[model samples]
Target: MSDTISLVVAGGGTAGHISPMLAIADAVKDEIPGAEITAIGSPGGLETKLVPEAGYRLELIPKAPMPRSINLDLFKFPLRFIKAVNGAKRVLKESNAQALLGVGGYVCTPAYIAAKKLGVPIFVHEANSKAGMANKVGAKTAVAVGTTFANTGLPGEEQVGMPMRSNVAQMDRAALREEARAFFGVSDQNPLLLVTGGSSGAQSINTAVAQSLGLLADAGVNVVHITGRGKQIMDASGQLLAHERYHQVEYVDRMEYAYAAADLMICRSGAGTVCELEVAGTPSVLVPLPIGNGEQKLNARELVAAGGAVLVDDKAFTKDYIAGHVAPLLADQHKLEEMSRAAAALGRRDAAQNMARKIIAEISSRSTSGQEG
Candidate 1:
């Protein structure tokens, strides 16, 4: 292997895609000093901000979302897709990328095509139990395929687990619990419930939790509810109430602390959030978003089956349901501890390192083959 290696990572749209991409990038850097990593994302997607913020050079290409129905956009798809592929080829050529690692999103399709055309090795990671369309296409010719869950149905897919941020991967929840609870203005002795619906928030979860705040507080559970940006929580008079034990915030900048303070989580189960909860060993009641091809439901299935978490339909995630199911769970310390142990047992703490090692080995193998040829 050379002193420096160059790789192009393609994935974006939401944090689910971008976070894992960055985790792998960070791991690659830690393993190989002076490695050049460039990110490819859609022009106006969330990756534009997050990729640069993570200190990686981001290159943009036009987004060519697969049209679901017969529409005018479907006719224009070929031109837009070709443009994205050419743009990706330019980035790969200019950067001299040895291999392309795709975490799976709209941006990755063109990147995969470009790598294939250029004879560059391609590796892919699928974060969901059911593979996304882009990953399914990429996997057909990918040199290796990695999945967060077992039995993803992709050919030769290996269960490497989801790569997580370094802080989360190395977090000692017990050691940081006291400080984390104090940071959120909660008592260290009280069991904490962390409620979130990812960055955009879920209306069902917000309404249910807001209405049941009194019940949860009465149960001696401290609540840290991240209501997502621009989402509102109000009393009957339409005023936001801030109780001593029920803390409401629009967003939390440092999720590590939230994970540290939480004894249990009540939230929508995106792939990233599910993996984060398991890795952090926080028991959860997952309310999967009831849209988007049922991906969230699939993401939470294994965790629920493992007894590390519970699954409830979004329609049933009401105030009454929380009072009946969640309030009792909060009271049972023995059950919570058991769930926590199960979650920790299933978590792969070294996922980022393992994925990075696989990627590097693929690159080394390609290099050797090229030299011999």
Candidate 2:
């Protein structure tokens, strides 16, 4: 095998897809110095910005979303998909990519097809328990498939856990607790509750937490709520009493600090969020988004099943629910500790490294076989 390998990573649109792709890219770069890593993403997707910012070159392809209903878009899908596949092939040819790693998104399907057509090895990583359409199709011809959860029902699936940022995966909440708490203006004695609804914020989670702020304050809990961009949350009560205890922000740039400050989390159950919480050993109240194909619920299942989190229905996650269920959970220190242990036990601290090694090995094996022939 040569001293370096060239790889193409495909996935984007949302942070859930992009974050893991970046994690694995970083791992591969560390494991093999002078390795060439290129990212393929749709021009309009989040990866256009995130990929470059993360210090990697990104190639653009047309966004071809799979149409579920019979419509004009569905009729036009074939041409768009072909263009995307061709764009991916051009990227592979220019980069001389030896292998393609798909993290599952719109970009992945075309990249997988292009890699297969060009006789490049393909590896797929599915972040959610419910496989995305791209990864589902890609897995059929992939050399191997890795998943964040077991029994994903994808072809040749292996449980490799979610690839997380190294800092987050290895964070020691206890060691950084004091500094993290003070960064958020939280007191040392009070239990801290961290609530977030991802980058865009969820209206349901925002409203419920905002309405229950006073109740949480009364229970002597400190709250740090990330309302995402352009989200303004007001206390539900006419008068804002004990406002100091309730801190509301649009977003948190330093999530490691937030994770360290948190004694408990109230957030939507996206795969990345679930994985990060587990890695940090933080217990949570997981309120899955009640729409789409029920992917959020599937993502939260293993954590809840492991007794690391409590699942509450979206409709029931209101002020009253918080007063009844969340309040008591916060007050119970012993139960919180037990839940933390369960979360830590379920976390895979070296997922990025594991997936990286697998990709490199597959590439090396193919290279050796080509040389032998």
Top candidate (TM-score): 1
lDDT of 1 by residue, 1-373 (tens): 8878999999999889999899999999999978999999998888999999999999999899989899999999999999999999999999999989999889999999999999888889999888988998889898889889889899879998999889888898899898888888886588889999988888899989988888888888889999999896877788986765899888886888988898889988888888888888899999999988898998998889889999999999999999999989988999999999888888887778888898899888878888999
**Per-prediction TM-score:** 0.97, 0.96
Candidate 2: 10-residue stretch with minimal lDDT: 233-242
For residues 198-222, what per-residue lDDT tens digits would candidate 2 score against the true structure? 8999899988887888789889999
What lDDT score is found at residue 361 in candidate 1?
A: 93
lDDT of 2 at 287: 95
lDDT of 2: 0.90
